[model samples]
Target: MKLTCIAVDDEPLALGLVCSFIEQTPFLELKGRSSSAVEALKLLNDEVIDVIFLDIQMPDLNGIELARVLDARASKPRIVFTTAYNQFALEGYKVDALDYLLKPFNYEEFLRAAQKALNYKELINKPAVAEAKSEDEYLFIKVEYQLVRVALSDILYIEGLKDYVKIWLASAPKPLLSLTSLKALEERLPARRFMRVHRSFIVSLDQINSVTRNTLHIGDINISVGEQYKDAFNGFISKWN
Candidate 1:
């Protein structure tokens, strides 16, 4: 996912340098550049900023003061203090700053701070899945920016990608993609109906068409059972015999 950011520094050279660093990073998008904390607040009010690369020493309302204002807000952007003075580093963390970059930092330092922001963003904003009812007949899967409801019975299998998963269904040819973890989905699923056969896959027990040596045929595809899960799967199969 891409994070929208803004640089707030009083010095022209510092502001330009930070902006340039943001532009150079592939996953980071530079939305605005402000010369002072007041200007940064104006931009923040007008736009949705994901992270702020802020300098602590500005006239009138300084970066520390600006950070205090943002910290109180319900949906404030993450802050990364960038200043020549190192004394404010302790204060910066009190506001939960993602990272602290001293002035005259190189591209490596900038990228590391940006990467930390990205991790924080993903951790807090990843799509959440929740059961729709007490009966567990249906559930909501957050896809992109919207929550999509799908029947539990309709789920044939689930294939997990990194930080995301694809839900194969009996009703649709294409799988439903969602930004969530396999482990998270597994916890929400009914233990009796859904079973984790592999680290990357969870299958609907009732949807299985057939079972081979170490694989299952569900819908029109075959999924191999993971080595760690073989004994449990075998024990589950023994119930049928």
Candidate 2:
């Protein structure tokens, strides 16, 4: 299936180059192009865009913010971050970007990213089986080219380390390593049962044995709640008692 997409970049030359690459790609159909995030948002609302080739640093609303906004939508398009600086790679993963293209990248790199997006699309859009199993109680995590089914109830907490996240599970002797950001995983979790109490930690509310002023004890493990996340964490605690 041909994936319809749009290109967004503040630089005219960069935007033109991405549009050209999209046109040359057999599976990608160019839907639109915009030099501003605001205009891109409007385009997304007006059209059925499947993927977005977005530049991270732009005037007014930046790509990262735009990504967050899009991610909250029910029919969000896949994002591929394009930036000159590699520093925004982590941020790209935060929004669950399919791939990232470093500036000065060739058509080869662009095609690779596009292919990844297509594969991901196929994985998520596959038809669900008619079964009694609770699909909402589990997640399909992509690990080493394979998608592994992980029960949400078996999870103790998630630990973020740069671009990777370690899923500590009650059923496993070792944590399951996955190449994804904590923020991205947090979005997949049921909000009522999971809370991001720290930048690097996402704790299951049911697994939390106790909560100190600034820390939470999950069995023997102690996780410190960040200062920024304290108020929200406390608010979560207050609801229980």
Candidate 3:
């Protein structure tokens, strides 16, 4: 998933460095850069930012105060504070900042902080995502600009492409296509009902017809079990029998 980010710092050099680092990161998209926390708020209002690279010591409005204001919002971006002081670390955590980056930090340090923010974003968003509905035993997935609902029981398997996934359903003649990564979808699936048999395939455990050696049969179709996933598949089969 690509996370939208903005860098906020009083120092031109510091903000420039962070902006450069953010641009180089594959999964991060730099939305804007701000010289102060007040300016960052204006940008936040205009765009849906996923993460903020904020500096704690700013004039007019400090990063800590800005974070508190953001926390009150219904939909708030995750904060990663970049400050020279180590004393504010405790206060940063109290406000639920994702990470604290001490000044003089290298690209590696900045990258680590950014990654933490990315992870925190994913964790917070998973429950809010429109992927699962346990009460109805169905999920609504975005397919070609439309939200399509598919019954859990009707799902045969899911095939992962590089940037998209094909959802194979028992009743549908054609598989449904959606723009989402396999790892993202897998996290939303019910562990008891589905299993990742290969890097490219996630099969419905209830829909499996049989298994022979390294291949699993779903109706007449055969899917090879990945070496890395073999142990988990074997454990699943053992429990089933």
lDDT of 3 by residue, 1-241 (tens): 8899999999999999999999999999999999999999999999999999999999999999999999999999988889999999877866767778899899998888777767655644676444233424877675642346688899999999987799999998889987788888898788989999999999999999999999999998899999999999999999877
lDDT of each: 0.86, 0.89, 0.88
lDDT, candidate 2, at 47: 94
Error of 1 at 143 (Å): 32
Worst 10 residues of 1 by lDDT: 126-135
> Relative to the unseen true structure, what is the C-alpha lDDT of residue 81 in candidate 1, on a scale of 0 to 100?
89
Q: Candidate 1, which segments miss by more than 4 Å at Cα?
A: 130-241
Per-residue lDDT tens digits for candidate 2, residues 1-241, read 8899999999999999999999999999999999999999999989999999999999999999999999889999989889999998867766778788999999999998899888877866666662225466888885643357899899999999987999999998899888888988999888988999999999999999998879899999999999999999999889879
Which of the two, 1 or 2, has more TM-score? 2
Spell out the clash pairs found in candidate 2: none
> lDDT for model 2, on a 0 to 1 scale?
0.89
TM-score of each: 0.54, 0.62, 0.53
- What 10-residue stretch in candidate 3 is worst by lDDT? 127-136
Tell me model 1's lDDT, rounded to 2 decimals: 0.86
